[model samples]
Target: MSIEIFDGIFRYGAMTLLLLICVFLLRSHRSIWPGRLGASAALCTAAYLGCTVAEQDWVILLLLPACIANSVFVWMFGLSLLKERFRPGWPHWGLMVLILTTGLWRKFFADADQMIPVVLEWAHQFIIMGMALHLLWVAWSGRANDLIEARRRFRLYFIAFTPVTMIAIAVIDLWLTPDVAPYFLMALQSFSIWVFAMVILLQAVQLVPEVLFFPAVVLEKNLPNVVSAVDQIAARDLATLNAWIEARDGFFETGLTIRNLGDTIGIPEHRLRRLINSEIGFRNFNDFLNHHRIEEAQKRLLDPTLARLPILTIAMDLGYGSIGPFNRAFLERAGQTPSRFRLQMPPGSS
Candidate 1:
């Protein structure tokens, strides 16, 4: 078979697999975001492959829409970082409309200047890169830490890395000469489609019912042993856990670190980290500390007797080195600034 025909077969085969996975995820997953994002990614991959095979100016038309769809998908993922459900603000929609209109004008009616298309391509690349980086930062900084373990793992492993790889591939495509384009296309197609397929499959497995096809009696029989093992492990740490709780007020010690806390509780640092993350439901160490500190600060802020106390003084007493961090954490947890919260408190609240 000719090399061109072989490439076509491989590209189409990958695209077909991706499409099937997207469909399966759409059917099985509860959230529509994953399905929609997967569909957009598949379509974007197909469009790029089509443009590569045809090598025609008209293919730019297909490529432009694909880019637009992928941009929306990236925006959706970015939103997922901030909240469980998000409605895209006007700025997002406005940017989409602007990109589409500019693309059409450049493709159909603009002057024969090559610079315009180059500029447009770079603009789209910048936007994609920004969204990708934002998603990665959210993952790396533990903004998604509150997610269940399965979803958290998925976000970190697949969602965080995909865009970095995509952006690298795009950069390679932009800079490489035509002589190397075909090889790059082949590699990009094979790697991206397979990676996506594997990620979706893993996610599907995670979403499966825990008991699967097992009979209830068998599951019940196995459940006790599993529960017993977990309980035993937890029980072993009971003393350390109790010590940590008894010293909870010590969380307000300035410059306190997890290592210090672990030492105080007589548990190793790694073990302490695991305990807090898995059992206590805290993803970030600072978040765990802030939980207690913020609660104490809120009580002080609302107390009429302490109403005369300055916010800065309250922040310092809570182990925050500065008022800025204290205010931000308070606003995040309480949905208002300390001052605003205090104003809304009942006049004689104790």
Candidate 2:
């Protein structure tokens, strides 16, 4: 029933400060859009903290204003990250305004004696859960950007702490009498401080230092970008051998050596070797050979016309030495056993 004697001002203030710093770091990448969302998140955090520290009735009025601004800003920031082509219009603004208005009403003037801030609490929960869900979707759907990656990493670091705090809150609310000091709340606050410290420590290793860490940073920043750069090299005019094309296109039956491929493509053997090893992101020639060959094997296995053929025949057709490695490669690429895939093929299919 009574506020704890310990001031929570420092905790909330520290969180607000850290979030604003993140927002500043994030704003450097505007086209990413999620960066702006992250900045808005920082603003909301600061607003929440400001509300927590307010002392007067006049100061308390600022809480609702802060909540309303944060709700609209956080929601718009979330929508911006969904990759839709069309910009949100008036209806979006109306819905956000409506949500913010209801939140403000609930927080500031719902009933005499401030009956309960139910709408405000629920709206805040909705925002937190919605943001978490969005990050989960981006992680699984392969649309994860750097901002999403940062959020995901932070979520992973802190998820284990949530249930302990929630259970503490619930137990206090239910079984414990109000007169009992909220000791568990203090414990939860301490626990969060530790979690925040751990998160910063872990994240520091991944951050790119502008001058010293550029090479490793570039690789870590985005795998797709590295893949794209290699693809560009492949597209350019290298004196590629006709044999290399044949090897890539499934022409070589046996004795498909790197030297032979280089001879056929007119590129020097060492150059061809380095291109595959360094640029193409594969370690060695055999692994490179298997990748393309397995790609062809996958197509054959999926083809209704080819499905009924003996698995061994498919293996031999793709230049594999035997059915065992062929099936392994197929399963690795397609995520299922070749036999299972064959059985699932439609009636009258290969």
Candidate 3:
């Protein structure tokens, strides 16, 4: 009885908190993708929790659509955090539609066939596990090279372990629950949901990072103050580092790493990381190199002498081993493939 009472209290409290979080995010940062996606996730969670408490079937009926989309919103939110120019393409929307369709089918037509429900249940679980694994992959990728301190921390905490917890809850609800589960077990599940809600509420309220809402474009507006922004490095030392990197002794190395670059330049790796993040306006080491490589590629593409040069040769000359990485980096930075970019530019224009 006591557990049930506490469970009800926590669940209700969490729902209220999630609503507040959604409201705050909508009011404060709705113009940004991360804020909007975070609010969507919060609302979905609140609706999901509400379904458990609602006595009326009509209430569940209305809230069910929103509730079933929790994972999709989470995955989108993580992507927004990763890249600044994230757009919800067909794949993202398609997955959402599939999740919604399956959910509504399972809820409305669940009893039509035993086999159908079983298949739907397994499909739903698979989708969830896939999303969880993707989020984990997204969080872990480029973590060491991530220069944004707050975002790195956010990935480590909210984006990393939270998905694992969600996966565990999903497994328990799907297959592990007995035919006649104990009341305490039920209470435990409710409490876990409440705790998940609480964690998101904290993050929404600026617990993890206020910069979580900052646009990636803002990071490129100005160069960092060498002495002020980077405490360990001085102005002259920075000039030397800049000169060395700009001269292409190491940036063009085929298999360059931050540690290797730092060792060559006689700077500590962490300080080098800070310098790139602050002074260079890049969040990743590879991004910094890609910026130089792509710039060189553009110049070469526009040169009359290189007009007949194969794109692969240009990519190889620019220190990229093959065309694939070069094309991907070029497309990401220039918004077009290398061939298209070359064709767009007049010969010898740049």
Q: Which candidate achieves the best lDDT against the true structure?
A: 3
Question: What TM value does model 2 have?
Answer: 0.41
Q: By summed lDDT, which 10 consecutive residues of candidate 2 come out lowest? A: 210-219
**In terms of TM-score, which candidate is stronger, 2 or 3?**
3
Whole-model lDDT for model 1 versus the true structure? Answer: 0.61
lDDT of 3 at 183: 58
What would the TM-scores of all predictions be?
Answer: 0.66, 0.41, 0.86
* Clash totals for all candidate models: 0, 9, 0
| Worst window of 10 by summed lDDT in candidate 3 | 217-226
Task: Record all residue pairs in model 2 with backbone atoms less than 3 Å apart, i.e. clashing.
Answer: 240-265, 241-264, 241-265, 241-266, 242-264, 242-265, 304-350, 307-350, 308-350
lDDT per residue for candidate 3 within 220-279, as digits (tens), equals 322432334344455555776777756878667786777888789888887777677766
Between prediction 1 and prediction 2, which has the larger TM-score? 1
lDDT of each: 0.61, 0.49, 0.76
Colliding pairs, model 1: none
Tell me the RMSD of model 3 versus the true structure: 3.2
Give per-residue lDDT, candidate 3, residue 26: 97
Task: State, as a TM-score between 0 and 1, how close model 3 is to the true structure.
Answer: 0.86
